[model samples]
Target chain A: MDIEVIKRYLPLFSKAFLLTVKIGWLGIALAFVLGILCAFTLYYKLPVLSTIVRFYVELFRNTPLLVQLFFIYYGLPSIGIRISAQLCGTLGLGLLGGSYMAESIRSGLEAVPAIQSESAKSLGMTKWQAFRYIIAPQAFNISVPGLMANVIFLLKETSVFSAISLMDLMFTAKDLIGLHYNTTESLFLLVLFYVLMLLPVSFAGSLIEKKVRFGMYGD
Target chain B: MEEILKVEHLHKSFENLTVLEDVSLTVNKGEVVVIVGPSGCGKSTFLRCINGLEDIQDGRVILDGQTINPPLQKGDNYRQRIGMVFQSYELFPHKTILGNIMLAPIKVQKRDKNEVRAEAEQLLEKVGLSSKKDNYPRQLSGGQKQRVAIVRALIMHPEILLFDEVTAALDPEMVREVLDVILELAKQQRTMLIVTHEMAFARAIADRIVFMDGGSIIEVSEPERFFTEPRTERAKRFLKTFEY
Candidate 1:
């Protein structure tokens, strides 16, 4: 409960906070792009790749994300593939985020009626062109709300990275508490950091969803 | 008259139930043919097959002297010449009315944007929607949306225009507005195949009236002859449903 000890650990926590932001942002960007591609594959019912993607989604979505991370970082090095801890965490989070985001996008695809796709095709659009110009933009708008929720969950899941020694905010918080024995102060700061990260995303997502709904329903 | 579209022995079945059986028809240049039948008579399916929207189990649909079904994939260049409008007015809800009209012209025909925009403006004006260029489909009424859909189809400068029950979903007051735009297109000597329940509209604008029943055309005649002299018993029975 020493105030001096808490103050000494502050700089380290801030550094870890910045790292957390970098990892989460990078992980989310990679995951969203990958997830959109995965979503399109499933939406179009592409030949063999659709089946393969389904398996990937189920495997990642069903298991605990922590286990997936541990298996990647700790389990894989036991074999021959040795990835950096940061890369492992990022990849693990991306894969996890991609699965949920893909499903979010898939649900958006379902919301669009079959007639719309047919309309695009009859207008002489190639399948890929129809998807790119017509389907994808609408689907992205429809899925934004669900995607934001997934991202918020992803931000929290970044905590699991602490277990792998990536030195994220949560990891630094626990380490500071272990050293200073100031549990209340350390945990409170950790909570505050998470809220700061999440509020903007939540607010921005809601605003976007409102715009999409307005575009779809007119008012 | 020059033949613009030819369908030869087209047959389609969905899970063993025949939707269109050995259907064959021809449309001449600048001709407007109205197909009238009861619901589920395969009129819409027949129209869809011509554009490669519905697959036919047998035979081919030749448009502008090219087989469109299993389109010459050599380059898929033929799609640039044909366009379709749906009954639901499937305007891309995400895009503005201007975007809807400009899509096929810019994307398929690869027309210059400035030129396409000018052409789209004219098209919007033709459809009586010049003021709605920036509005989304969701902002328009059913009639306004259908007009935009018609303009979207026309901007492609298609050799043939297919109207699939264009006014079925409109309010009684909105029906005339859509038919007015379509009737105007008809006057332009566009090759048009309209599937409609508006017996009176058919009576007015159709140069030829085709009566379809059980997936086959039972009678094809001038609208005057069609109203006065229906050949098949089914056509006679179908005619009785409408008090024309």
Candidate 2:
């Protein structure tokens, strides 16, 4: 343990960790809302809105997250809509991940038979009620595992913020290494930090998957 | 007898393929009409069309003088009024049997939960599956699931019930239990339109039998005459194939 190194890096690590948590969860929350609304609009094929969403999905899905971030962070400023690195990173990640999230949710909803909606309708449920009560619940249960995996992927993708100068954990660790040339310790600590951050989400995801499987199909 | 349902000159097509063409039928209140036909004769499509699941190119389905057409959003109450049991059971697998039975009434109809729950338990008892109330659809046999589906429909107190080859997917042993439930429903004299391959069950419970072939109604007659005389050659051939 280098006493000077530990004392010096601790403040940086703490600041970086708080930023990571804030940016990561905010990105996911935004993605989750976009995923739900856009998935539904895609499902119903709402005329021009659906077409725009389809193009958005394709653009985001096909391009790499780093390019999207660069395009947003650097390219946008040239167009006069200057954005902070933190905003660019969070928005880029949220929008990019939202495409995959929409796909996962749409696939889940589709897995429920059209007859389920018909049955609900035949029971006097309006289309909205049928979707909300009958189809959505089943879709959610079926989709949890895929969506959970999407979340974990998105969590890891938050590391791309390092490319822009957002002081996320990755950026902090890299900066520490750059300053002190302590590659092994700095890199290993970053890995440990990521594992600690990500393990809980994956573990909770697996447990939910089990409960959903049991509830959906029974023993 | 008051006519509960009247479908006139119904036409349905999917893309370029015609399913039901100029199909017409009338059902009186408390009457049970069983439709028998070969596979892909548009029997199931007709049932689906009645519930607005299929878009009809032209036709009028008058239930109590209210016309039903595709995109059934306007006549939302028609769903509660006319219940349908599909061949696949279509039970909400995520819900318990009791939940499936009470969902429409309590949630869709916005009825009191305690009252609906009591009625649902009674109906579950009528189906002889009170013990299975808390069980999920996956835990039930095909026959039991179909029976639960029927109870789910019956809970709505529908004016007319449509069965679309409901027993077709069940095993032979499973078929009888479901047929027995239909028989009981017929004995209760709730208006029903049944599409079935079980000629014996159709003959036993139907007030009249409708024979269809190639998307057209070939014959409609009393059960005795339908079983014996069958007016058209197609009906005769259809009955001949069923004899074995």
Q: Best candidate per lDDT, number?
A: 2
Q: Give the per-residue lDDT digits (tens) of candidate 2, residues A118-200.
A: 98888888888898888999999888888998899988998889999898999989888888898776776678778877999
Question: Candidate 1 lDDT (Cα, whole model)?
Answer: 0.87
- Looking at model 2, residue A108 earns an lDDT score of 87
Q: Where's the lowest-lDDT run of ten residues in candidate 2 chain A? A: A1-10
**Number of the predicted model whose DockQ against the real structure is largest:** 1
lDDT of 1 by residue, A78-153 (tens): 8999998889888998999999989999989878887888888878888788888888778778887789899999
TM-score of each: 0.93, 0.94
TM-score, candidate number 1: 0.93
Write candidate 2's Cα lDDT for B104-136 as tens digits.
998878899999999999999998999999998
Point to the candidate with the largest TM-score.
Answer: 2
Task: Name the TM-score of candidate 2.
Answer: 0.94
Model 2: TM-score, first chain: 0.94
